[model samples]
Structure formats: C-alpha cells, structure tokens
Target chain A: MLPEPAVAAGKATRGWIDPRVRLAAALVYSGATAVWQKPESIAAALGFALGLAVFFRLAPGPVLRRLFAVNGLLALLWLILPFSLPGETLLQLGPLAASREGLLLALRITLKSNALLLALLALVAPLPFPSAGHALHRLGVPGKFVQLLLLTWRYLALLEQEFGRLRRAAALRGFRPRTDLHTYRTFAWLLGMLLVRAVDRAERVRRAMLCRGFQGVFFSLQEFRLNGRSLGFAAAVAAAVAACAVLEFGG
Target chain B: MHISEGVLSGPVLLAGAALAAAGTGVGLKKLAPDQIARTAMLAGAFFVASLVHVPLGPTSVHLLLNGLVGLLLGWPAFPAILVGLILQAVFFQFGGLTALGVNTLIMALPAVIGYGLFSRFLKGPRAGALAAAFGCGFLAVLLGGVVAGLALTFSGEHFLNVALALILAHLPVMILEGGMTALCVGFLRRVQPGLLPGRPSVEVR
Candidate 1:
C-alpha cells in the first residue's frame, strides 16, 4: 500500500510523532483557530504549519507543488467569484468588473483553503494511518467508527490493487468496450463481480471478528502514555496558541 | 465531496455534533450487546463499500451504503453511520474533524427513517430490502448535498443558488445510486435473507 511507503518515508525522515502528541496538537490548533480572529490567527496557523512541516520532515517543494496541482482549479473559482459577485467595482478588466468586497472575500476564502490544505498535509501525510486511527479512537471516537476507519484504511489499498488486477486481466483478454453502452455493460458486470467478492470477504471478516471476541470495540494492545514530554508538548502548543490569541487581541 | 475546515462556523459544527451524539445515544439504548459485533462488521463493510467509487460527472462519488445499513440495522443505523463517518474522516480525511457529526447525520438519518418506513410498509423480504436500499441511497445523497449547501450558506455563501446547484448535480447520481442499491438489496434478499434485519420472533415464525 502507498500508506506503507508514506509511513516508511515519514519514519526515515521525520521522527515518529506519537499519535497522542499529534492529537493534542490538532486539538490545540483547532481550539486556537476557533478562539482567535483572522490575520493574527492566520499567522499563528502559518507558524504552526511551518513547525509541523519541520517536525514532519516534509519537503515543502514537493508537498506544496502537489497541493497546488490538486487545488489549482479551486483558485480559478476564486478568480471568477470576484467578477460574478455583485457590488462596488474596485478594478475594471476589459469587459469584467471585479468588486472590491468580492475580491477581498475571495482572497479570504483562498487563504482559508490554503491553510486547511497545509494543515492536512502536515497532519495526515506524515502520520501512519494506523496511528492516526488509534489517536482518533483514543480521543473518544466510537469503537464502531474507529473500526470503520481501520477497515477503510486496511481495504482502500487492497481495493485499488484488486481493481488494477481486474484492469490488467481485461487488457490481457483484449476486452475493449468502445461505445458508452458496451462500457456500461462491462462496468455493470464488474460491479456485480465486485459485490459478490465483497460479500464473501465480509462474511469471512465477520467470522474472524466473532472468533476474536470482538466486543463491539476493538481493543488496542498499545496504550498511550501521557509522560512529561507529552505534557511539555501540549504546553508548547498551548503557549503558541495563547501567544497567537494575544497578538490577535492586541492587534 | 468532503467539506474542509473553517468552512462551517463553530456553532453549526457543534450543533451537528450534538445532534449526532443524541442519535447515537438513542441507537445504543435500543441495541442489545449481541448486536455490537454485527454493527462493527457493518461499519467495516460500509467503509469498504465507499472505496468502490463509481464515476459521476467529473468527480466520482462513492456509495454511502446508508440505505443498505438501514435495511440491515434499522434503528441502530445511527451508531453504524456515526462509526462509518468517523472512520472516513480520520482515515481517508474525506471530511473534517468538526464536520464529522454533520456528515454522519446527513447520511445516516435518512437510512434510519427509510428502515422505519419501508420495513413496516413493504410486504416480502425482497420488496422491503429494495425499498429500504433505494430510498436510503436516494435520500442519503440528496441529504448530503443539502447539508453541504446548508454549510456553505451558513458560511455566508449563496443559499438558494448553491442548493439548486447541488440538487442539479446530484440528480443523475441519485438515479444511478438508487438503482444499484435496489439491485444489490434484491440479490441479498434472495441469497441471504438472514442478513436482513428482523426480530427474533420473525426468525422463529
């Protein structure tokens, strides 16, 4: 799975951030953002993002490039929003009038999007999937929900792998569906087959869960210890948030 | 698609969270301990199901399978849906942490209602299954779009325009998802009727 590769990269590059620490950081970050206003809060977020980038050992060039590629179209949407939204025009471009208020609003949204994207990259991209799941579970996410998270994490790669195999098999068989009709028919058959297999697999998984005395909640053998360092980490996050709040209020 | 952070305000997100918690509490009270294992399995199934994304327009929309969950779990659909969305948000980052409750309620509430309505009204097992599945699927997507629109509106984005846009976008998706769910439920009913949710007395009968 790509998760394995990502995890390996994270371990080799960035030190393993205990799920607990990450969870604490995320909570603090969210709370701080919620409490504080814009500009100063935005600066705090950027500072956090920078810190996260360093701790996670992320290559900014690569991650930022990837982020831009995925979200580039969204930027275009902002470009149109200014012109399309009614109000006072600040700038005139040929036939279009860009409203000052609308442009500012679009800019605000764009910043929000970028911040969110950066936060996600800093958080999940570096954290191991299992660790992230465990962290969420520890944070009082319901067992059933955690299990779903675990299964999705476990199966997404497998599903992609399976799809790849099926695609290869089709290629080998020289099965080419030309028109939309033929394509839909092939897709339907594929869908039917996938369902059959999924059902069969689910039965086995259910049986396995039963055998393990799965008491609705999945039990993790690894327990998170809230040591001095963790507390220190939490304090640091809190301090940073406090400083951000002060700056926001002071400003 | 997943709504990002800060898109919805703190109040709206908190409200969704509170509602979701209430739903889960009710669901838990109704469910027996023996049902826990089944719920866990279904949660896993729901997670896996979404990964099988069928193409819709430019972006591919995955099956929510909320309808199937309702048909199988009935009132307990709340907890199952909650678990499913929690996993989706954490593992896949499909939605934001704050928005998890909103997403779950939007997707799961319909399934719970569908189960209540269809299970009582429908005659045969196959008919019940089809009705539940189709209804849930159709409504779940519609609700998802609606909720997204609502969130956008709350954020000071366009209300009617956004709502209309979402509804129009999801129209074709609803038909496709509804049809697939109906067929799946029909097949499941024929092959494994026991999988369908039923009271112990019904099994005895």
Candidate 2:
C-alpha cells in the first residue's frame, strides 16, 4: 500500500482511529436518531454534531468542499421540501407554500448529514487503508474478505497509473471525447481495450505471485500494538457514544 | 455514495452484516488457492476505482467496477467487494463499518448479476469489457439507490420519493461510468488481451 497519512499512523500503532472506525461511529450515532419524531432528537443531534466538530477538529475548508461537492445539489431539495411537504405553511409567496415543519425537517437532516461527514473525515483522514483493514480483520471481519481488501489496495495503485498512461496516450492521439460520433466510438473502444488490459495484467500478476512462493495469502508487515493511546481513543469514543445514548434516553 | 453506521437501525445493520458474512463465505469457498493473488490484485483495483471521481452535474461519482470485477472474477466479487468497501471506508471515509453490509450488497450484487448476464451479450473481449464495465457501474448505482430507498422505507422514512430522487440523479452518472468502463476495457484489450475472462488469446509475439 502507498504510504499515506493514515497508513503511517496505523504502522506506528495498530489500534488507531482509521477512517472506517470514525465513519462507523458517526453512522451509528446519526442512524439511531434519524427516525426520531421528537424535537428533542434534533436537539440531541445538533449537540452531537457540535461535539464531533470540536473533537474531530473538522476545519471549515475541506468539510465545506466535500459537502459542496457531494450534497450541494441535493440541497436543492430544501426548496422542494418546504413547498411540497405536508405541514403548516410558514410563508405564502405567490403560489408556493413554505411549510414550517418541512423546513425544520430539512434543516435537521442537513445538520445531521453534515455532522456525520465531519466526524468521519476527521477521524478517518489520518490512517492508512491496509492498517484499517487489519484492524477490522482483528475485529472479526472474515480473513477472505480481508485478503481481498489487501489485494485491492495494492493493485489499485498500479492500475490507476496504467489508466493515467492510457488516458495520456489517447489524448496524444487526438482522441477528444466530444468532437463527433466517431470520437465517442473511439472512446468506447478505449474502454474496451482497458478492460482487456486489466485482465491481462491480472494474469501476469498471478504468474508473478506463483513464481515467488505459489502459496495463497499475502502477509502485512506492520505489527499492531494496543497501547495506552489506543485505549484512550477507544475509551473517549465510548464515552461520547454513551453520552449521546444517555441524552437520547433522557430526552 | 456510502452510508455511515448509526444511519440505520441496529437490527438492520446487523442483519446486513450477517448477510455480508455469508456472502464472504461463499466468495471464499469459490476462490481457489492459485487465484488468491489475482483476486487480491483485482480487489486493489476495485478499491482504487472509487478514488477517481468523475464530475457529473452538481455531484461527482466515482467508478465501482464491481461488474467488471464480477465478470472477470465471478463469485470472487463477494470477497473482493467486501475488501474494497472496507478500504474505502478506512481510507476515504466513504462508508462506515456498520454500514459495510448494506454498501456491499448495494454495489456488489449488481456487479455479480450484470457481469453474469452481460458477459453473454457481447461477442468479443472489447464487447464483453464494454458490457461488463458499463453494466456494472450503472447498475451498481441503481442498486445502491434501491437499497438506500429500502433502508429509508424500513426506517419509516419517505421511500418512494427518496428512491425517485436518487435514481433520477444517477442517470447521468450511469452514462459517465459506462463511458469510463468502455475506455478501460478497450485499453486493456490492446495491451493485455488475455486478462479478460473466458477469452482465448493468441500469444503476444
């Protein structure tokens, strides 16, 4: 696996807050309260979001960039929700009826989603993927699946490079995507070629693997150590989760 | 787009996790010892596929290539997808650990099915690649939306509306994915023709 910020941390310590851990924590936190009918749930969600924002150190930039990129378009639903959803109208502007309840609901959903995103990105951004996979495997994810992940993680980098080369080669050949129908056909043909190449590469890779040892299973070199920091991270997360649960229960 | 944990009910996520485990078992059972290296490499490819996001409309979606994986690897996709999704969540925060099962089923099943069905539709390696690549990507997203809709419905949220909105949003995404798949397949054919599943190749001189 390519050396990444997350991988470096994972190699240093086995029990690190990989992106998956953060994402899972965020998802569970949000999913639990997604369906709550009470306004208290929304308040709790807002609090959780605020807590995550603080703890995760989610800066305004990357968070906004990702949100703008992923959910910016979906935000259009805000307009639709207010007018179409059934509830008391907050405002009457010409033909549009803005429902107070629908607007509140939309606001809650947006806040919840954004919070989840912030928490996940903050938590997962530091760890490498393979280390995270190993963590999951240790947590009882099947070995076979873990193997697949390790392999995918390794091969994807090479393949992506191959893809970059192909794209460059095509561009040099004057293969523009939008010039005409023929260009489109050429583009199609390029994709067909990429698939065939990926498979061929797979065969060579298999052969290379056999020449090395002929045995199945790839081993990761990094060793995991559960030290004070890991326990601390885990404990902190548990406390946060418990706090949320308590808030939910109390409210 | 991947969902996080706590986004759904505990029972639902657990159920999905169980199903994912079963699916992983089946994938493992199907894989031969010799195929492990190839399987791993393909899984890596699948994992990286998502990192390259192609812009479509206001939102951007990356390639899944599960169909291509399924077409090339067959039942091995189960384990492969499991790996890819795990990595995505870990490396990219695309999904969550609890949401892994739902994410896997959402993307991988369609890959397995599309590769199975479309492999027969095309005549040659290029066609097979096109069919598998496009079908896998487009169908995977559609399946994902369906799953998302179902999850929302199960939660007593608005299923149909969400489904419609998601499915509609994904139409252009499908086209973009299809185009990329075709290109990837085409290049593969020129450089390494033997890689495509079920294709007999003349030895490259």
Query: Number of the top candidate by DockQ?
Result: 2
Q: What is the DockQ score, from 0 to 1, of model 1?
A: 0.24
Report backbone clashes per prediction: 1, 43
Question: Each model's TM-score?
Answer: 0.80, 0.75
Q: Provide the lowest-lDDT 10-residue window in model 2 chain A.
A: A6-15
lDDT of 2 by residue, B1-205 (tens): 5554434655666667677777778878899877776777666655544555444445556555665666667777877787777665555445645577877777767767766776553336456556666776577667766776776567535435866777787777666666665665555556554565554544331
**lDDT at position B155, candidate 2:** 50
Q: What lDDT would candidate 2 get against the real structure?
A: 0.62
Error of 2 at A61 (Å): 4.0
Pull out the clashing pairs in model 1.
A145-B83
Residue A14's lDDT in candidate 2: 33
